[model samples]
Target: MTVDESDAYVLRDELPDPETFAHLREVAGMGPRSLEAIERGLPNTIYGVIAVHEPSGEVIGMGRLVGDGGAVYQISDMAVHPDHQGKGLGTGIMDRLEAHLEAEAPAGAYVNLVADVDDFYERFGYEPVRPGSKGMHRRIE
Candidate 1:
């Protein structure tokens, strides 16, 4: 049965528990993350938000911000369970994250995220940094 999101959903200022976090990532096809890293890192989150199915108490979506307490921050681990996509859960997560950034991140701080879907991030005022600059990453062995 399709849940009528207007009333049966909740956005909470909380991180998903490790298992739920991992499961959401998998279901969203975001690939795998180190469980050990997640265990160590989640507690240090600057701010995070989770969407839940109120009746089931299940995490349906989540997003988080992490970085040095002062200047730079990155939005990471944004995902929604496959069954729960297209219902504005991702937007709800971004709304909370944006509020936290507005409230806490200092002026001139750089906020960035790697986007699998540019259209989604673009809606939040993010633009590609191509000709003038670029994004680079190195995975640790």
Candidate 2:
């Protein structure tokens, strides 16, 4: 992030623990995720970025890269706690994740994210692959 955050947060290149991950996701308005899923899926993250509140050492923001390491990569769980929104933690999280892909991903690696917010990912070089190709999903029973 271009904004200075050194005083309040320490950005870490690691995923948060399962409980913290679930809580952060819910408080950030992404809604609650199953602990079962969090535990199962977090281990698969190829790379993750975390923002820790220095005063409390809480994980306030995060983003992760998940997919087969060679060709497919998706930016998932991009969120910042509502109280911490304006400090650029979201962008900082993305910055670290993007840097990881740049250094580690292959020549033709595909990076994508489901942007729930408008225009946020475009600055990071993402465009919609919609209308012609829809993004589909199904919840496991």
Candidate 3:
């Protein structure tokens, strides 16, 4: 899917080039788990999208949906370069991601994400998992 923004940005699902992925990692302050997952090819299950600055051919923003591809999908690693944060790039990326999920994920699949910003994701139909539901994690030490 291609999403063209009025600002001359374009969104495409072509797996990000390595340099772009590295830029995304740096912008997001991603930790070892993210590094490992990205490096070990584990996030290959990822559905990745990038916001490109057409004139420069630079990736200014990115996000990914990762899961088993059938039942559970989580939006993760969403980021926009600090220089580009206020211009709606993040929202554009999510718009594309949500559209993909709506069209492709199987019926009854639970789409989930951990949001660093409270109100931003609500606009996209994501709500916190109910209070008692656990969000678990294990990190390599």
Candidate 4:
């Protein structure tokens, strides 16, 4: 299926839909609770644009911005399906997310993303937090 820009709307709508939650899990290598977290937190978060294929209506790429609106916003769960990689879909999602953050986020709003690829997010203007600072997480078990 061709990745049409217009199909972005379909992705946006599907981001919160439970039907596509499984697809998200596969892409992110996460479990059902991850999907639950997304569903639970989606209302309080700011999700940016998503891009999908038109013909099969599959969710090919997705990214989202989370955190408090004014003080902090984080880019999270950016993923493109395996079959859809190397075609700039991830970049397209980031472009949309950045554009949204740029236009909407207040000054001093800290935007962050935990990137799997070392250099990829740098191209979109993300950098390591600091020398001493580090990313922390806790998993429920």
Candidate 5:
């Protein structure tokens, strides 16, 4: 019920198990994150897309949308396993996330994301917020 048929890979509209989520992020070069954060944050995802390698049933890619549904939303934790690069899985994930946002977010809702590469996100109508606003964040130890 979670995965679609006809392929060695599939996308599921659900959160990956925490272990898979963390593992994919690391293998995808996103760096390791606190397990505590993963546990605390995943449940709050307004939507999550996970790519599974059907042969292994391994979650090899993921992306999440988080924030207040009516006003603020962000596309976060996007990553694909290194072995799965150049296969358009990222695009597939983003397409899913964007569709969900388009359907669920309010007309004026502000959607944002911290993009590692601008060009990839540009294809999705996301542009730099520069000249108006900049992204800032702080780490909590």
Candidate 6:
């Protein structure tokens, strides 16, 4: 999608529709998700934002926060459509999520995410896990 000078991008506090959300993930080289899972999971987001291309009404980007409401929080599912990458949409998504965390996260809440690009997240003040503290995960088979 060619973003013309006149094309307006709007960021709204809402989850992308499942089709657009899944498509963005697929095109962005992420895994696909079932419609049923999308339907069930989106409404549980503590906060989320979707960037829409005004001219085409396309969901070009998205970011979401998830985890226990009080003690733990995580920023996840941050993705922008390949065509829309480098247009500041990723920063916009992170800006919104960071704002939410700043305003709402409890004082002692532990926030974290696994970064594919350390530099991108480092700018936002997410540092490497401290020495002797390893991040681990197990994928569902």
Highest-scoring model, lDDT:
1
Candidate 4 collision pairs? none
- Candidate 3 structure quality by residue, lDDT tens digits, 1-141: 775553577888855655667777687765424544566553464577888888777888888888889999989878887876788888988988888998899899989887867689998877767695887787666
Instruction: Show the colliding residue pairs in model 2.
Output: none
List TM-score per model, in order: 0.92, 0.91, 0.82, 0.80, 0.92, 0.90
Question: Over the stretch 9-42, how does candidate 2's per-residue lDDT look in tens digits?
Answer: 8899999999989988888778678999999999
| Candidate 4 residue-wise lDDT, 12-92, digit = tens | 522535446557657666445565665676566576556677777777667778888789988877777777677778787
Distance from true location, Cα of 132 in model 5, Å: 0.7
Q: Which of the two candidates, 1 or 3, achieves a greater TM-score against the reference?
A: 1
* Tens digit per residue, CA lDDT, model 1, 1-141: 885754488899999989888888888889787888789889999999999988788889999999996789999999988887888999999999999999998899999898977589888888888988889998776
Task: Report how far residue 45 has shifted in candidate 4, in Å.
Answer: 2.6
lDDT of each: 0.89, 0.88, 0.77, 0.71, 0.88, 0.86
Q: After superposition, how far is residue 121 of candidate 4 from its true place, in Å?
A: 0.2
Query: Model 5, stretches more than 4 Å misplaced?
Result: 1-7
Residue pairs that clash (backbone atoms under 3 angstroms), model 1: none
Model 5 lDDT-worst window of ten: 1-10
- Which regions of candidate 2 deviate over 4 angstroms? 1-7
- Put down candidate 5 lDDT per residue, 25-119, tens digits, no spaces: 88877768888989988999899999998887878899999998889999999999888778799999999999998888888999999988658
Residue pairs clashing, model 5: none
TM-score of candidate 1 against the unseen true structure: 0.92
Answer with 4 or 5, whichever has the higher lDDT.
5
Question: Which of candidates 1 and 3 is the stronger one according to lDDT?
Answer: 1
Q: Which whole-number lDDT from 0 to 100 does residue 140 have in model 2?
A: 72
Q: What lDDT tens digits, residue by residue, belong to model 6 across residues 1-141? A: 785854578899988888887888888888778888888888888999999888888888998999987899999888898887788989999999999999999898999998866579988988888695899998655
The ten-residue window of minimal lDDT in model 1 covers: 1-10
Candidates in descending TM-score order: 1, 5, 2, 6, 3, 4
